[model samples]
Target: MEARLSKETVLKLSTDHKFGAEGNISTHKVEFIVDSDFGIPGAVTVVNGYDNEFFLESITIEQNFHFACKSWVQPKKLDPEKRIFFFNKAYLPCETPNGVKELRERDLMQLRGDGRGRRVCSDRVYDYDVYNDLGDPIMGDAYARPTLGGQHNPYPTRCRTGRPPSTTDSKTESRPSESELIYVPRDEELEDTKQETIDQGKLMAILRNIMPAIIDKIMGNEEVFDIDHYIKESGQSEFNSQLPLSRILLNLGGAVQEFFKFDPPKTYSRRRSHFLLDDEFGRQVLSAFPLSIESLKVFPPVSKLDPSIYGSVESALKEEHIIGHLEGMSIQQALEENKLFILDYHDVYLPFLERINGLEKRKAYATTTIFFLTKMGTLNPIAIQLALPTGNPNTSSKQVLTPPKDDTSKWLWQLGKAHLLHPHMRYTLKTNAISRQTLINAEGTIETDYTPGRYCMQFTSAAYKDWWRFDMEGIPADLVRRGLAVPDATEPHGIRLLIEDYPFAADGLLIWSSIEKLVRTYVNHYYKNSNAVSSDNELQCWYREFINLGHPDHENATWWPKLANPEDLISMLTTVIWTVSAQHAVLNFGQYPYGGYVPIRPPLIRKLIPKEEDPEYSDFVKDPQRYFLSSLPSLFQATKFMAVINIGSAHSPDEEYIGGRNDVTSWVGEPEIIDAFNQFSMEMKSIEMEIKRRNADPKLRNRCGVDVIPYDLLIPSSGRGATGRGVPNSVTA
Candidate 1:
């Protein structure tokens, strides 16, 4: 049978195509078909089957815009409700000002493997309707649910929340047409759904009064519109009070957009200090799970790396201050034992500190915080160093503060951790920050902005590969590189993390290993062995393009892993899927619950540690608690960050997790491959239960503190909304 099709104007394409544009010729006999205008310079069309029954195998646009050369799709049956999208990248919506510099996919065999599942993921877009009448001001803002972008959500999460029998949790909320493309994709077969753009409207009738507040907060401020070094508060009125626990609900319940009111100095009372400066295990425990566990590294031999931003490594940070906490162990002994860790940000933020601190009320620093892993398997901060730029670039001014000896030092140390953790967010997303959000905006710091055009992909890729090492990204390797683990054949990936009970690495390794095993089985089935892997011209060419085109800067880097064998291929593919799924799940998803309390983990430190000579130092000395409040974000900034994270952290009503079914199993003929995927899914279910058990275990205090919220972020299961939990296959949130 000849493949035939019909078409419409070219909508944008979400190329995270699996079996998508591959043009694979297998046992199937139907010839690939396309529209007459398919190759034209500006083609806008969607392909439908002759009877709207054509399940697309692969798609190609040999001659066209440089942004996307080909489009492939999964062979999902189509009807009136389903259609394959060919949306151009230009028309795609972006939450950040800089449009998608690179569409998720432009090549057939993507840099990230799709053999396991979808390589490209997207978050659904929701229509604006704060009051269902606020209209276009908030139009197209991303919905704050853990949703995916597809025609249908096959495995919509069943929210299993406990209640007093009054709360209503949605079971089958539908997926939306719009999605924010989350990850890059690679090659594989797909039974993809045509992303449909539906014109729909819904509103919370009660939130009518709050619409103005939200619109003003998101759309009104120069702070939201413009970003200097200083982080500004979003607008919050007296009307915008706290919703029981949810900020998203607070605004939706009509408690937002009412007016602008600064969280008064008095409001920043002893309460704010209670979490950071006062609590015993405040900074240490949060780092293990929901926040940046990836940032920790085995304590360095040298305390400082950049002399321009630092004077000497040991001058400020000393051994005695931390040795006391290491259980009578010497500094060298503790480090040798892998018991010492540090979150170092001195090199990343030093340059930005000057600009970030230019504003009078704002204070930022390049910092480092050292930790000692306690016998309890929890990390305890021992020392913190705050460094400020001295304009010389050749010389620096810095101070090292340890766990408090006095009330003054206590507050100072807290400020140091805040200084380090705050900017860590900015730099961690260095790729995103420089490409999509912070620097890519037209008026951003980069004058020769490298985005919004043909070179956008190349520019971002080149810029991306330069900032960090790609080979060291996987969780297992990262752990080893940081000296937190040692090679142990018994362990996953032949490496065992030194911290036996570290929550992030522990939960993630379970998920990571399952993915590796499943992908290894599936890839071996296709490639046969190492010789086949190296001999495949298409695979080798794809490899070159991945290194040279996708990450040009690293093109000559010898450290890059090769797809020369099935094992090599398995390792690489597993990293890709694991990064996008479990890794992204852990790094994200818990932002609001852990950081929502501004006092617990503030993203922006509005004020710097005051010098005794400075006037603010007198005020700080008088009431350090109030001084800390003045130094943090204003009410508006806090709310804005909260709202942003809340939107980001929540799961959509229709999110598909790791084990959730896609159409992968039906087409593959090999029972082994099918069995591999089924086994992977089953193991994922097992992982979900495993994580639940761990969360409930009273012994794992890092996750199950009686007073703490369970660290369920890694549960390969999800339900609707931000439940401080759930891990989908991609970083949709």
Candidate 2:
């Protein structure tokens, strides 16, 4: 039999055997029939069947035969010359295939390189095939050999060759490309991107938190930006090292500045202590105390008490609780009663009195008078009358004074009367005993007197003289005698009487008497009847006979010269005419009359004296009475006094008057009356001064023991209008 060589066999022989001649017969040919499943037609070759055979030429194997070929009878090794042998299948008999018919050339051609055939070849070659069965290739018949140039397998020459046969039979699975296999870099790179976003968010948050703080810093309120330091310190940490601390702080500061740019400038106030001992007072007191003493020769004594106690005393003095003991009492009594009252031992009184006297230089006598009267309580009645303009009783009335029914009226009237009688009286009277009873009725059951303490009396030297000499020569005696002069019996020929005896004990008696006499005289002169005779019978007779009988118009009748002595009437009439003519002259000619009714008074006598030494005295000498009496006319002209007296058959008439006319017309024309009263006041004031001077004689002064210098007296003229603007002077008379 001839050996047939497959392509695999050839490849194996080529690889295993060399071309060197060893032992083979010449001109030998071997042929093998292969099944179609084995290979393609040209793929097989003929070769010695045994390993000992060799040939010099290419061997060929038949496409569909299975046979063996050898050159020697026994598979001998031939010399190198006999190695090439030819085995011709044509010489062998044509026989049918024994077991299974071999494939033909064309069929073998179809089987070449097929995965099924390759698999069969593997099975036939090896007892058990390691190659997988190829039931159906995954890539179907279009499978191509894998190429190494790309991603395909390089070893396998067919599509199904590299894959396991079962894999190929299952289903086609998609292989991933390079890009799909490469995953997103999720470790450090992704973390970095996420961290960057967080850092940006954190920066924005920090900026928002610190913006306000920066604004405050720029506004000069550094405390508001205290967090900036913290932020800087925080930024220095490793975690925040990259943060721009200075830039961020600057930005925040700028934002703050912009926010507060419109704010007003800050104001700073130096602290001050209200304590008087502080720096301000220390300097002031030191300078003032020394300078004041040097200038005025007066130093307020410093107390020996502790400063705290001195402070308390200062406070008490400021509050008026430490009034000098002499305020509401006679100087002698104040000196004696030191323990009963808080005294301003500071001796402020003399200086105050000097100040008051200085005011007199400025023609501020009214003000000075008011100050003294107020301190002494003598101003109370005037103050009360002013406050209740309608309630006060008539100043000229002799009737019992009746106060209003109201408690306030009663209290005020009593207080005013007490103050008037005794200017030093302090306690306000309480007529409502229930009020005092209530106090006594309190839980303590203590007994307390409703009346206040002992009353103090204050009187000017002039007042004392006038009051003491009432019966002897003052207004009381004058009024009691109905404008008559009386003799002083004690002085014998020293005084003469022009009128009968009249009692002048009580306060209102003199004023009332004067008012009555004036009313009687004027009414009698006008009505042609005796004003003093107002009995019902008398009035009836006069009314029927004189008034009702049209023949004699009694109501309009004038009795200018009938009732009074001609000389006295002429004198009175002359005084009135002179007063009117003087007024007319001043008004019309703008100058006073040169001489008329000049009295022989001291003021006038002083004016006539020649003063060569003092300028002020020279000026006074030129017109001393004029200087003193310049204000008197105006004062008297404004006087308004109320009177209660019998008139027209009634005990008292409702008629009010300016002077004496019962007609309302007279009341309406009060200015003239007031002017007359003011002039009279000036005369009275001159008289009062004379009286004081007379009483200050050596004899009287020796009798009084004390130096009887008149306490600066203020004789309030009746007609001068009230001081303190329109407020009635009587309000605090």
Candidate 3:
């Protein structure tokens, strides 16, 4: 028979047995007994001697109310609260009960055994009440209700056979119906709970892996973060504010200087301001970079750099200049060397200096006159002229040489002569202050000495009114009028007389230097040689005729012997023809004050120079008639001419003549005339070429090279409808 054990005796035995083998036990198994009063299998609590629970296993209580027990030994001492209680019997009858037992009567179950010591012992009898009715009993809660719904018996229930409830007999009872259990949960509430669980998991993982440095920064750790310096250093404002002026100038000057180093470069250099006072040096620097000593001193001092050092730098700037530097001495030594200074001045310098006292005052007048003329003409003559008095040289009652009243008139006449005699003198007037002044003061007196080889020139004015007087009164009328002379009506009258000389004898020859010399001579002779008061129109006429005829071949004729060759004659003739034609056009069609009309005729000698009467000669002369006619239609149809000839047949006879009301047809109807002229000019050009070719061929004319095309035949026609009335064809080599 099994021994009957009270609950107190069982509890005491469990405690004593567990403590006695505490160190010896390597492994232990615990079991629990079911309490019929609680409808649960009561479990044994495995604990240390100090009453610290370690584990629990379930056993069973029989219908007679005896305790069944099991035991466990801990590997290490556990916390009293963490121990688990296990029931040795299945809770449900449907569950298999492999280890179910009655807790009241049992043999001494071996709870723990020492593997190392080879020790085995029957030890603790587990207290079943600890698992069944102790504080917070395992497997018992309000949420968990039994599936077997009826009130359970306080003592162990009988098995299905009405025998003692053993492990096999307990499973034999009819299993509780599955429908007896119930559960209720809100779907939405469950989903929210699940989402919160996932979020918490992610947050914990992130926090665990984050670097301490980054975490501290995010967490407002003052020692790890900085913002003040970063904000201040983020923009361009500070960089822009500190830019220096000297650096800008350096960049600009460097750019300009580099640009000037190229051949055929810009007229102005980058360092133009720095070199402003040195005209020659500026030009040299612009052209080649480093300037020679001779060129350097011309400019005023703007820097403290020694001239020699500057020269060295300048020389290095130009590849060619370097060679020159090397030829003298080492480049360094040459740069340092100082030679005797020779103050060289351009004609512009003196005039510039004169206005220094009051630059504005001088700039107002001197700049417009002297500077302008210097640029237009040459510097020497303008300087001399500007230096001269504004009045006449008085010698006696019979001799008074007055300064020229019509400067432009004299200049234009000289210009015309120059164009006629020396067509190669095509120098453009410089547009400096002096030239501007000359242009502005174009009406001023232009006195010149009379000489054989001088006459052709032009001048500027210092003011608009002066320019007007020259343009309106002097240029197209008195000075350029063909075969006519008109004296200046204003104060300080001066005469302009042309002379026939070698080169100057040619039509269209332009000898600019000769023109200048002639004007100079006129000034000198009138003041020194001639009795200025003599109003000998014959002498004037003789001079005019001599000029009009160009140079003569007659020996001892006043200007005949001066011509060097027949080539000179052709050149002069060409120049004269061009000048006269230009003048005629200006006077007849241009806006001159005289209503585009001038009372002038062709030179009598020009008219009287008898043309060949032969039909062949006339044909040759008229060969450009086709071209002339062809050009006329367009010329006459122009709006300007139409405006000029707007008056109709009802107008007065004088007006009618001017307005194209004679029996003659309108200019637009004269195509045939222009065609004839064009054909004639073409033929004339052909003939001219043939003559030149013949002259050039030594085999044809003993190499004498005489121009046989008659001067009169070469002259352009004056009549509107005539052949070859305008510009002739150009000659080419």
The number of the candidate with the highest lDDT is: 1
Q: Which tens-of-lDDT digit does each residue in 1-733 have in candidate 1?
A: 1223434333332344233233533322223355675333222233442321223333334422222223333223332223233323222122211212222232222233322332223211111100111011122332112121112211111111111111121321222123432222112111222011000101221232143346556664223211111122434333334545576566654433332211221112233334553223433344333223433434443544455444454435666557677788887777667777766666555545665566444566666777777777766777777777676645658777777877776777666666665401111221231223222222222212111111122222323433456677677887777666787998656888766656777787788789888887868667766787787665687677556544443467789887788888887887778777777766667665666556556666666788889988887778776676666655545555555455456665546678775445233335676677788889988988898898788787666764444667788777765566777766454
**Candidate 2, residue 541: lDDT:** 46
> Cα-based RMSD of the predictions, in order?
16.0, 66.5, 58.8
User: How close to the true structure is residue 108 of candidate 2, measured as C-alpha lDDT?
Assistant: 31
When sorted by lDDT, best at the front, the candidate numbers are 1, 2, 3
Which candidate number would show the highest TM-score if scored against the true structure?
1
**TM-score winner between candidates 2 and 3:** 2
Give the per-residue lDDT of model 3 (tens digit) for 401-495. 11123543232222221111101111111111111122111121111110100110111111111122211222213232321123444512232
Indicate the TM-score of model 1. 0.63
**Against the true structure, candidate 1 has what lDDT?**
0.50
Per residue, candidate 2 scores C-alpha lDDT tens digits across 1-733 of: 2233443332243445433343432443444455666433322323334445332233343433323322121122322221222222211112312212233323233323333422211111111111122112344543311211112211111122222233444332222222331111111011223234334433443444354445544653212112112111222322233549986676666554444221110110111111111122112111111111111011111323233322211111111211232256643343243212111212221112223233221111110000111221111111111111112223210111223345433432332222211010001111111112222221101111101100001111112322322122223333334322334556322233221111111112222233334434443343343433333233344334322231121223343223233333323333333222221111111100101111100001111111246465544445443333331112111010000000000111211112222222222224444455445435444533543453354443211123222211122122211110110111111
Off by over 4 Å in 1: 1-274, 277-315, 393-395, 423-467, 665-668
TM-score of each: 0.63, 0.16, 0.15
